[model samples]
Target: MRLLHLSDIHGRVDLERILRAFNELKADIIVISGDSESSSLLRDLAGRTRVFYVSGNMDSISVVETARELGMLLDGEVLDVEGILLAGIGRREEHDLNRIRKEVKGDWILVSHYPPLDTKADIASSGRHVGSRIIRNAINELKPKACLCGHIHESPAIFRLNDTVVVNPGPAFMGRAAIIDTENWEADFTRI
Candidate 1:
């Protein structure tokens, strides 16, 4: 299966280019990590693909409401897509690692706004590398197949931990995206 992973739109709703790319690529699933400031963009995207999204720090309640209205599942929801369990967590430092541990099963994909711990990616402002402790705990415990995240826009790195692949797609509005081929277990970063 081909999956398109994008994150950190930050209110830039230029769907025409994204749609063209999607159509050309013919991706089976689309995962939007977070920081999408526009509800309308989410609504528009929801209709185009099997979309799974999480709420970022910048996302408002109204944006989530619009997502729910458009039949999109918000944060802390699990979607079983063709034998793969796709789960999402919102932007919260108080993450329930135990719950994630219990809920995830068999070739799961985890989505969050922050990167996992010890990731060697560069930070934006301070130039320090920092990853989320909550996500680190989840990775250590749950051991999902892959984790996709995007909060630190400058830290765009793909790391391998144990059997899992952790990736931060950077800022999607800035033309950064990742295409994952589940069949081959490969992810390719693309710049549009």
Candidate 2:
């Protein structure tokens, strides 16, 4: 499966640009990490292809409701897609290690708004690690196949924790994204 990861699009970008990227990249699934609140864009993308997303801190209730209506909300739930277990743990505010561990089981794919603590993807502009310790602890416990996340707009990177791949697709409002192929769990970033 080709997973196109996007994040931090706080409704500034256009749909045409993102669609063009998705089409050109030949993405099979679109994983949006957080801060995307444009309702039109969400509907358009969900209508076009498979989308699994978690609500970000900036996302409004309407956005979450829209995702739920479209059945594209991945927060606090697991969905089996082509035999791959896809799960989510939304924003950083609700980071519960026990709840996350209990709800999201197995070596599945995790969609979070914050990158795991201390990884290359978690560094802030201030140089201090503002990542979620709960997320870090959960990753150590769950060992997901890949953790797709965002929110630290300055840190866009792909790294690994043991066998688990961690990816932050930059910020979508900046016209950046990452295409991760599940066959190899490798990524190719595209910046428009």
Candidate 3:
């Protein structure tokens, strides 16, 4: 499956950019990690294709409300989409992590706001690793197919964590996004 990955959409990305990428890439799914508070953009995206989203530290409760209203929220839940299992954790909560561990049966993709600790995807502009330790442990043990995350605005690259591919499209507020072909696990990081 082809997946369009985006994160940290805090008013920099317009609907035109997202639609253009969706059409040009022929994406089958859209995975939004977090920090999007634009309900109109979310609604427009929902009208175009399937969207799964989480809330970030910068997001408001309205973000979750909008996702719930659209029935596309991915926080603290897992869903099987076209034979692919996707587990999401919006916050660094023990219950959410444990629930995924107890219920997830097979290979899945992890979508979160924070990246695995000390990984390439979670470095701050100051050079310190600000990722989630819990997420790091999960990646080491559960080993999801990919981890789509973005909290660090400058860290927008694709890398490997053992067997899983990790992609942080950086901040969409700065025109960053990605297209992933899950069939081959290749990513094309681009600007929106």
> How do all models score by TM-score?
0.92, 0.93, 0.95
Candidate 3 segments exceeding 4 Å error: none
Whole-model Cα lDDT of every candidate shown, in order = 0.78, 0.84, 0.85
lDDT of 1 by residue, 55-74 (tens): 78798989877876776654
Ten contiguous residues with the weakest lDDT in model 3: 91-100
Candidate 3: residue pairs that collide: none
Error of 3 at 85 (Å): 0.8
Best by lDDT: 3
> How many collisions between residues are there in candidate 1?
0
Residue range 77-183, candidate 2, lDDT tens digits: 78888778888888633543434566565547888898889989989999989887777877787888898999999999988888888999899999888988888
What value does the lDDT take at residue 178 in candidate 1?
86
lDDT of 3 at 20: 86
The per-residue C-alpha lDDT of model 1 at residue 90 equals: 77
Q: What clash pairs does model 1 have?
A: none
Q: Each candidate: how many clashes? A: 0, 0, 0
The candidate, 2 or 3, that scores higher on lDDT is 3
Candidate 3: how many backbone clashes?
Answer: 0
Two-way TM-score contest, 2 vs 3, winner: 3
